[model samples]
Target: MLLEVIEAIRERVGKDYPVWCRLSAMEIGVEGGITLEETQVVAQLAEKASVDAIHVSAHLVGPGRRPPMAQPPGTFVPLAEGIKKVVSVPVIAVSRIPPELGESVLQEGKADFIAIGRGLLADPHMLEKVTSGREEDVAPCICCMTCLDSVTWRDEGIWCVVNAALGREREYELKSAEKPKKVIVVGGGPGGMEAARVASLRGHKVILFDDGDELGGQLLVASKPPFKETIDTFRQYMVGQVAKLGVELRLGERFTVDLLDELKPDAVVLATGVIPFVPQIPGIEGKQVLLVSEVLFGAETGERVVVIGGELVGCETAVYLLQQGKSVTIMMRGPELATNVNPLVRVPLIGRLKTKGASILTGVQYEEITEAGVTVRTETGERRTVEADTVVLAAGARPNTDLLTSVEGKVAQGLPVGDCVKPRGIREAVEEGYRAGLTL
Candidate 1:
């Protein structure tokens, strides 16, 4: 049937225009699924049918079906190489092929061409940046899969965490501000950085303040886990952008009323982010208990670690601890693990935890934290203690409204963006930050 369709299209086009056949080189995580050798045979057949090129791709089907966005760059290049060996026609390799990897793929004769999909969505000027030798300016796709997840799960339009101007190029176009203001942005998280970047681009004099010595707020912790280092790329891009745009960076200094009075800016953007929510469980204040940030930030952990909260943060933290060769368990009051995580990310993340021997307990009530471990009542109404030497709290966060309430009515134009308004993921933070900058 595929050959028939190819023939029909070729006959109609009279071989004048290029027509490429995209083949799933491998069906990952599926029993009896398509294999590379089979795909090579398919590619040869397609070439006989006069297909101009064979595009090597992959599919994660059955229960493992997910957006290939999470896969490493050039994930399918080997498949393309396999098919190229058998076919005379060019083979196009895809699946998260960034420019640098694509160039190496070509040099190594892995593929004749590299097809970039989501990377283009994140930064439409990707090729332009590469051509102009300004590749560092390209906004990177962090593989959050928010673009695919929005359409697949929510039936909504596409959204990119790194590129808020996506699908709204005209509306988000940065025009020189008719009246540029002195903008004071508080917090150095994604939101705060974004606010400063946009405002500076609009010709505003922007000064960004953060208590931490470094620029990244939660990203410093978010990027610590394995397979999540891509987040740091986006963070670095933002930091570089703000620096390049000449946004004043006042790190290691909190945004207080004293600073506000001293700067006396025309507008204030509060991207103060969030603080860890400490639950009322007894002994949570004990020295054995640590926040999620503490663990991710290199705090010493015991041989046995119990992480409270089974959401994305908790699960990822558990994975981090498991990688550290620690016995780890994740406990949550809810009935599900990684319920707040995107399905594409949750599947592999949960699998990693289980594969690494993580004990996941859900539908439980936290009774208390003790020197031994966390005591909880399971769904079956049984009391038990999950033995652990350390208790890490991944129980979510509350909006850091400290600066928000303090600056209310003090500034003529004050806006609270990102987690200061509500504690959510990167998408909300970045989008809100961009909007707040536009609002100002």
Candidate 2:
């Protein structure tokens, strides 16, 4: 049937237009999956059918398998190289192949062409920026999996976390402001930096402030975990953008009412982020208790660790600890683990935790925290003690609205963006930040 269809299409097109055959190079997580050698045979057959090019791709065969979109750059290049050797046709390597890696793939003679799908969706000008030696200007795809998860699981249109002007291109088109205003954006997270970037691009005199000495509020700690360093790349890109655009940085400076009055800016955007919320329980303030950020930031942990909370932060922290050869037990009040995380990420994350010998418990009630470990009431109301040397808190966070409350009604245009509006992830932060800049 493959040969018949190819012949029919060739006859219809009069052999003038090119026809590319997309083939799966390998099937992951399947006992009897298509192997590279089998794909090589298929590639030979497809080439014999007079196909112009062979697009090499890969697929995950079962649940809990890692999504290709979240994999590292040039993940499928090896597959393309395998198929290329079997067929004389040009082989196209794809799946999260960033520009730099794609260039290296070609120079290594792995594939004749590189296809960038989600990368282009994140930034349409990626190629132009690379060719012009302005690679930093290109918005990056952080592999957050929000774009693919929205379509596959949520049945929604695509969205990019880093690039806010994705779907509504015309609506977000940056036009020079007829009258520029002085803008002061507080909190140097994704939202605040993005607001500064966009506002300055529109001819506004923008000044960004953060309490920390360096930028990238939560992102600095977020990137510390394994398989999440792409987020740090995004953080670097944002920092460079704000710097290049001439947005004045006031690091290690708190944006208090006095500072607001002193600066006297026309507008104020609060991207103040969030504060960690530790549940109330006996011995909650013990010396052994540490926040998830603290653990990811290199705080020493005991050999046996108990993680309280099974959401995205909690689950990822368990993975980080498990990788360190520490015994980990994840305890959550809710019935599910990583319920807030996107399925594309949550599936593989939970798999990694389980594979690394991390125990996960749900429907838990915190009774108390003792020196030995955590005391909890199980789903059946049975009191039990989980042994641990250190207790890591990963429950959740609440919006930090201290500055927003202080500067209420003081500035002419006041906008609270990102997690300060409500505790959410990078998507909400970047989108809200972009919109806040446009509003000002």
Model 1, residue pairs in steric clash? none
**For residue 300, what is the lDDT in candidate 2?**
99
Please give, for residues 1-440, the per-residue lDDT of candidate 1 as tens digits. 99999999998998789999899999888899999999878899999999999998888754334333446677678889999999998989988888999999999998999998889999999999999999889999998888888879977678899999898888888788899999999999999999999898889999999999999899889999877888999999999999999999999987788777889999999999898999999999999999999999999999999999988899988988999999999999999998877788888787788888999899999999999999999999999999999999999999989878888888889989898899998888888889888877
Clashes of each: 0, 0
Where model 2 places Cα greater than 4 Å from the true spot, the runs are 61-70
Query: lDDT by residue for model 2 over 266-307, one digit each (tens)?
Result: 999999999999799898899999999999999999999999
C-alpha TM-score for every candidate? 0.96, 0.96
lDDT to native, each model: 0.89, 0.89
Candidate 1 Cα deviation (angstroms), residue 294: 0.3
- What's the lDDT of the predicted structure labeled candidate 1? 0.89
Error of 1 at 379 (Å): 0.3
